[model samples]
Target: MSQRDLAKHLGVSLGGVNYCVKALIDIGWIKAGNFARNEDKRVYAYLLTPKGIAEKAALTARFLRRKMDEYDALKAEIEQLQAELAADGR
Candidate 1:
């Protein structure tokens, strides 16, 4: 998708998308190439490098672990509330 489309889809400003894309390119995570034979030279296709894929996987794992920890804490809180209610005969 075009940068404008990406920005709209992500609910961010166009400049925000451009900044992030540039950062990824600079870090060797993603490569941006013009679409061959496309009339518009401004159009680019962003592809993830192998390093990017690995980074994404690691990020996903961390996100899941954090969410699981949050879930466990919430479950414990709920159980404690239920126990308090039972003790109060509510």
Candidate 2:
């Protein structure tokens, strides 16, 4: 997606999107290519490198694990509250 589109989707400023994209390119996680066919010479496409794919997978795994931990904590809290209510004969 274009940086403007990305900024809108993320609810962030255009400058923030540009900064992040530049950082990603600098880190070799993604590569930016010019689209000369487009009427606008400023148009470019960002493609993920192989390393980027691996990094994304790792990040996904970490996010899922964190969510699961949160779910378990919430479930435990709910069970504790239920037990307290039962003991109080509510």
Candidate 3:
């Protein structure tokens, strides 16, 4: 997305998006290039590099695992509480 679009989507300031994008570029995780347009002569576009794609996939997996773990724990706790309530009612 454009920097402004990223900022809005991320709930951050435009300048913060610019700074983070610059850092991503420097880290070689993302590539940046100029836009070829009349009014956007100096504007840039960005895309993830191979490394960045892999990192994103890995992070997504980690997030999914963590979320699953949270869900399972909640489920177990609820079941235990339900069992206790049943026992108390007997």
Candidate 4:
């Protein structure tokens, strides 16, 4: 998608999208190439590099682990609250 489209879909400013794209490109994580959409139009296509793929996988794993920890903590807290209520004959 064009940068304008990306910005619209992400609900962010065009400049923010532009800056992020430039940063990714600089990091060698994503590459940008131009393609012809029509006789008079050119559009850029961004593709993730292998490094980017690995980075995404690592991030996903970390996110999942954090969420699981949060869930476990909440479950323990709820159980403790229930036990307290039982002790009080509620």
Candidate 5:
């Protein structure tokens, strides 16, 4: 994605996206290549390496687990509040 698009979607600064992209390229996690946009200009494309794919999978798993834990906590809290309300009404 373009750095500007990425930054806007991520709700971060454009510079932050540029820095992260540079770091990923430096670490060999992603590669950047220029594609012809027209006769006069080119656009950059970023491709993920195999290592980057693995890392993304790992990160996704971690994020899923974290969100699941949060969901469980919130569910428990809601149930507790409902029980308290029921008791108070009785």
Candidate 6:
């Protein structure tokens, strides 16, 4: 998708997408190339680089681990609370 499409899909403003994409481009996470030309020659397409793929993989793992930790903590707390309530006969 183009940056416009990405912004709309992400429910953010175009400027937000531009800022984020620019940062990623600077870090070598994304590449912008000219795919086809219209009446103008300023259009370009963006794709993820190998570095970006690696970053995505690492981010996914980190996110999953954090989510699992949160889920486990919440679940254990709920169980403890249930047991306490049962013991109190309420």
Output the lDDT of residue 67, model 6: 100
lDDT of 2: 0.95
lDDT string, candidate 3, 11-53, tens digits: 9999998898889989888998886765867677688999889
Candidate 2 lDDT tens digits, 1-90:
788988999999999999999999999999999987889999998999999999999999999999999999999999999999999998
Better of 1 and 3 by lDDT: 1
Task: Compose the digit string of candidate 4's lDDT tens values, residues 1-90.
Answer: 678998999999999999999999999889988766655455677999999898989999999999999999999999999999999999
Once superposed on the true structure, which residue ranges of model 2 sit more than 4 Å away at CA? none
Which runs in model 5 stand beyond 4 Å of their true positions? 7-15, 36-42
Model 2: weakest 10-residue lDDT segment is 1-10
Clash list (residue pairs), candidate 3: none
TM-score of 3: 0.83
lDDT of candidates 1 onward, in order: 0.95, 0.95, 0.89, 0.91, 0.90, 0.91
lDDT of 6 by residue, 1-90 (tens): 777889999999999999998999999999987857575566787888999999999999999999999999999999999999999998
Alpha carbon deviation, residue 72, candidate 1 (Å): 0.4
> Candidate 3, 88: how far from true, in Å?
1.3
Ranking by lDDT: 1, 2, 4, 6, 5, 3
Candidate 4: C-alpha RMSD after superposition: 1.7
* Stretches of model 3 off by over 4 angstroms after superposition: 37-39
Off by over 4 Å in 1: none
User: lDDT for model 1, on a 0 to 1 scale?
Assistant: 0.95
